[model samples]
Target: MIAKLTDIEALEAKGFDAAYPQKSPWDILRHQAETRPDKVAIRYLVDASDPARDEVVTYGDFARRIMGAAKLFRGLGVTPNASVAILAQHTPSAQTAIWGAQIAGRACPINPMLKPDHIAGLLDAANAKVAVIMGVNGELDYWSALVPALREAGVTIPLLACDADAQSPGADGVFEEMIQTASGKDVQPEGDETALAAFYHTGGTTGAPKLVQHMRLNEAHVARSCAIMHDLTERDVVVNGFPLFHVAGAFVYGLSTLSAGGTLIVPGRLGMRNAAFMGSIWQQVERYGVTILGVVPTILASLKATPIDADISSLRWLLTGGSPLPTELADAVEKHTSVPVRNILGMTECAGAIAVEPVHGTRTPMSCGLRMPFSEVAVFGETEGDADPSKPLGPDETGIIALRGPNVAAGYSDPARNIGTFLDGGWLVSGDLGMIDNEGRLFVTGRKKDVIIRGAHNIDPQMIEDALLAHPDVLTAAAVGMPDAYAGELPVVFAEMRQGSQAGEAELIDFLRDRIEDPVALPKRIGTVDEMPLTPVGKIFKPTLRAEAIRWAVGQAAEALGVEAEIAVDEKLSTRVMVPGESVDAMKDRLAGMPIKLSVEARS
Candidate 1:
């Protein structure tokens, strides 16, 4: 195991090719199973409150289960080029399905929370030959609704259910029973390093999802890099509550810990969403002797609020990602838990990790640490849609970020979507705006599409968000652009207050007024919500906030024109405002300055 990473160059000196000899994820798992058969690979909590009920899987058993899963998929006609779609929570069976499908063919892990039609579209997009879904259980039930939707969508793939009731209908077979018929000894690894291993969908909530093709090499590269960067060892135990659908759960925390021969502790079926698990998470950490705790910003905030009733001295690092880690929140968490918070920069296209703050390195606020070894991360001048990688910007020059490395995915499944993102020369353009310092630390500003344009001036919503987050009463904050009649777009802030804080929007806006130095960046209005809308992976869902802002803007305009307006926002976030026939021209004139396809029509 790596002792520590003093510098990125020092880590790179140990040549990447020589350090990671494993060609695929299966190869790494096989090596571990052969070398340390008795070592615990996964410790699954059956109930967070009961330690004795935990189910443990040794490396030998885990490897065999993956092999069995592979054999099962292959027996069901899953070829090397076909895919095995998975729709389950963070359970042992789900883990098996993911790795096993990769070995036999390819794994397409879809979000179980998505609508049936969206799930069907993803299954169709991946060309899945078979699907394994979580069965109708007391805690979760997606089968009843999903089965008919797939049929309606004309998706006739075979369906298998895991953790299902014996009498559950609609499923062709049970995953556990079907796998028992297939012998693990007969399974063999298929595909080369460059072959496709998984199909991960991104951004399906708004429009058609883009399928990211992760090759075997990409997963292997990230596993090794993450293990080394996090200084993981067999002696360490990691608590990873992330879901399997996200790359952070599958690779960044899951495979990375196992690849290093460490024990991975998965929270119960509901994972972090389980209130009991989260309430007693500290006790569980102490019970498992967890050395590393992986969580998103939202979980971290919840942990900070939850009193530490148990001895958690074993935790060495609180690794957070999947969203911008507010410096204030990180500082608060570190102060409360006395554990250093290490930030990670990741994307699904890059197999989950682009950079990680070294466990032993100095903790720099707002910095995502050094780039991964053997990968090139550069910033370029922001163009219309794509940034030119040929001309890289200098240090401290804030611009668009681009990356190229073995960890990068081959490309999206839809080749047409690769024009701006997957460019020539193997460079994958990161839509995030960031800058590298002279010391090689990456500081991500925000997403390129997240910038709020105020006339000719470009305003970053992060500035407003950071200011609002500085308030002690604020629990979560997000900023978006509201359609403005004259300024094109104006900054608006949304906040979720801490429990029982009684913080009002006027008071929070007053607090931000003193903290914000730039006049243009100051929010025009502040709104409060019971809770912030978060993605399944726990990042703040900005699109929802943007849509709310547009609706609010249209309401204000209609009120001024003395006419009622009906606003409809489509999946693409295009707004259609229907008003009285007499006010159509006035409404169009009022909203003409906004940068959107504003369709103001007379109410039919």
Candidate 2:
């Protein structure tokens, strides 16, 4: 039985099996290690820019690192039952840390790049007893004192700083120093494979992040789902360009590729130098005939911006996820390189892809393909009045996507959030607004939560303001995604200055640079407003602000580069703003054609 958003009221949890075959990500990893121990598991291009010293790890060695790191964590007084947290970066060390956590016992991967307050909140929320922070030289906190403050906030968990040297004052233990943290002893997990594999917090409409408890079963299911789509094999050399913290980078795409006994490729970052890295990717492809590779939408878009002369002819597959696959960009890549671009849709809780277009399959612009085996999906009628979740909707109907299979989460870390996100039906509400077509293709329609995806990075506007407000002269600020041509969206800020105190835009930008690690997470452009746009509920009316931003953006575009007489601008606007991707004439015509309507669905 399949459940979707159309008729969510009718779903029930007793409809499916909890313990099914093809479960356990660890089981899959172990299987690959035993079967193809000699096979090259990952070919990490240390610095894609530097070709001379590319490193490779065999399946046997990769498995050993995981086990070794797991043992190391236990030996360091991070007990089995106690929560051990790691902020996974975009490097191979990130992968080792996550896999090691699972081997140790209870592991929950958190985005270490998040603001310190949120990091503190998540650490507190997880009740972590020990944190294996990336060390000072290895640590991202080179300038700021966020780490010290975290320790002060009762996050007195043993902090083992891990840099290249792995030595720093105030450090409880270095990872290498505690190679025998657990010695030959391994902590037995409190729950069996069915207990919980890991916890990942996702954004909710309530503006709070909910911790999703992915089960051991779904972990394997998502991995298999990804492995099958790309025809993952021991010969394939995979590139790990996406953020390891994201589900796509961690499990669905990253682990699945590694689990297949293939060569894993880790690029430094998905920015300007990516094309140069492609030369390195081509070299690995030529050296090992690297067949399969995964790319986030951001890197793909960046690759599209500058011309690539390197022969991607060695490329057999190009799978894209984390955001919608823009058709024009996808087409541009295919036109440049012969590799077919497949759109994949999966979530952190699902473990891997729920659906992915077949390789060399028919291109459908932005179609997220059919559901994997044992996983049922459907579309429902939103206003159908008590709709059935078990039944699939007919053609062209739009609704939320619900999943019931081995690949879904068991429960959440927070008990309160568990009730709303998941119901008595055992169906996780996926908050993503999407629709399934008659042919079973899923199209992501919209997001229920007001999140802004700027260059494939999930930046909650509120999450951004959490940093901006720290500036004494800054009264209040709002974070928004201004439309972009190649970048998709750029972060912008609407802020107010404090009375009797003043701060310039450049000064505020510098202040944020001191506080936040990822400069992109902070607002690129700042505008002072009399008052912030807010809803009656007091949550900043982000939608209204987004609209204003868009309108201002379109107007600026028109004013800077004059538009036709049919489209005139309101001269009162000084700040630059971007509208949703729409032509000026189209938007003007839309406004011109509309007749304002007032309704009383239920009188106020």
Candidate 3:
């Protein structure tokens, strides 16, 4: 289903147009306005002192404003194909900016909350033609301050201000100016399939950012995937507080909802820490009957913690992704809000979620469901070297995941990325260790690079992390595979306690005894930490944590097990065992002192 040059036009006709009437994300929005002009497209929840009052946006009005913003950009000489960067919180304006960019030419969605260094890096990397800065609260921090920094880092893009809150002094007229231009513009894109759409960035585990170049045709395919995956229709309404920068924010939920003719609900920000802000989202859900809600596990976890539970009955389903959902968090979220929650799994390299659990799932369930349409999946045998698909493993056989499909990103911003993930054959290495069951469900087992080997038995860090988080008192946990001289690699778990609650390491060890099927799978060291290290997206940052824990253990993990005074020979085989994480060289050095004889038969 790779959109080949030969079949692209045909595929475009059969796949995209059949599913959606409007050509592009922007066009679909405009079409929604024309067909259902007065329909509500977006409802913005504005936080108030009491946490009940909020704002709203009708589809017809949303379209008019988007057009106005596009016109404003046009008046500012924001020509077609010029990259426009959006630096703002997840809100109606952010969505408007993205649509405006589509109408204007090109849009580069950026995380406004990104660290200054990363922000500068991405700006320079994109060589953005212009930047539209939206206020991050009252700080009024505009993109103007970033101009000099971007120049230093190799970017000279001009910066403009978006109305809400901008910090720059004496800048050009705000986004309103662009909106005025879009209103008056007598010309529009002809829904051209050849038009370049947007660029998305992905940096999962590889620790290096890679850009995903999407053409208009690819976006249309992504829209179709979203439409089907979410079960979206004209009657549906979504509260899209998810960041526009993340895949879940744009491709997974946002643009898909629009193409489906469903209304959108946005908030000033998705920051749940501010009860007032979060309450606004709940208000929209209740007042406007926001049926669809998409968010990350971390955000959902925080929302579950909020005590005030007003009416959220309008929310029929809540979608969570970006990281594995801890079972405890999932259960708590269900208890707090009656909405159904499903875990979605995929990456930016892929347009959106390739696998997601059903919407009506009861309680938190395992396994992201059957592969979506146009997805090719294979689980290669988990081995030490280059992955081989010919020797693919069976159900429950943990291995690297390789996928090829229409929605997969064409290539990274850096062509060199293809060397590791994509071969000449066209498959994309997911870089994740996963398995497909006979039922065709996919279970992601941590990063392939994070596999923990203890003794001869290989361990999955994700498995132990799952067990640790299952503890009632535990809030979040991360298990890092550390070097051990005897067994090869042993796992050290760093965990955090729930707020205002304390649980000892002994309790954790006992909990593991009840949860884990294999005795050896229990964590060797349960280290209590204030919190687990996490990336911006909340996935465990174990490389640095693993290094820190090894130092604290003081070589205990590296020590060999001392022999008992009288070693009894067992007639039966000791199937359940603890072998040391020993390298070949270290194993030989330790074996030199033992009386055990090396046998060719055993070695073979």
Winning model by TM-score: 2
What TM-score, computed on C-alpha atoms, does each candidate reach? 0.76, 0.77, 0.67
Using lDDT as the measure, the top candidate is 1
The 10-residue segment of model 2 with minimum total lDDT is 593-602
> What tens-digit string does per-residue lDDT give for candidate 1 at 1-604?
3323346667678776677889799999999999999999999988788889898999999888888899999888888888999999888889999999998889999877666666787888888999999888877777877777777878788899997754457888999878767864566666579999999986432235578999999999998888988999999899888888888889999999999999999987888778888878888888889999998766776776778988999999999777656565677778889999998888888999988888878778778887888888999885545698767899999889889999999899989989888989999987888899987889886566566655323455776787788899888899888876546578899989888897777787788765654455678889988888998889898888888998999899889988999999875577899998999988876664454545889998
Q: For candidate 1, give the lDDT of residue 27.
A: 91
lDDT of 2 at 34: 84
Better of 1 and 3 by lDDT: 1
Off by over 4 Å in 3: 1-17, 20-23, 48-55, 68-81, 115-121, 136-155, 165-167, 182-187, 190-195, 204-209, 270-273, 279-284, 360-364, 382-384, 389-391, 449-604
Compose the digit string of candidate 3's lDDT tens values, residues 328-403.
Answer: 4566677778767777776666666566664633332446655555556778864445567667788989888887
Which pairs, if any, clash in model 1? Answer: none
Q: Which portions of model 1 miss their true places by more than 4 Å?
A: 1-6, 205-207, 451-604
Candidate 1 vs candidate 2: which has greater lDDT? 1
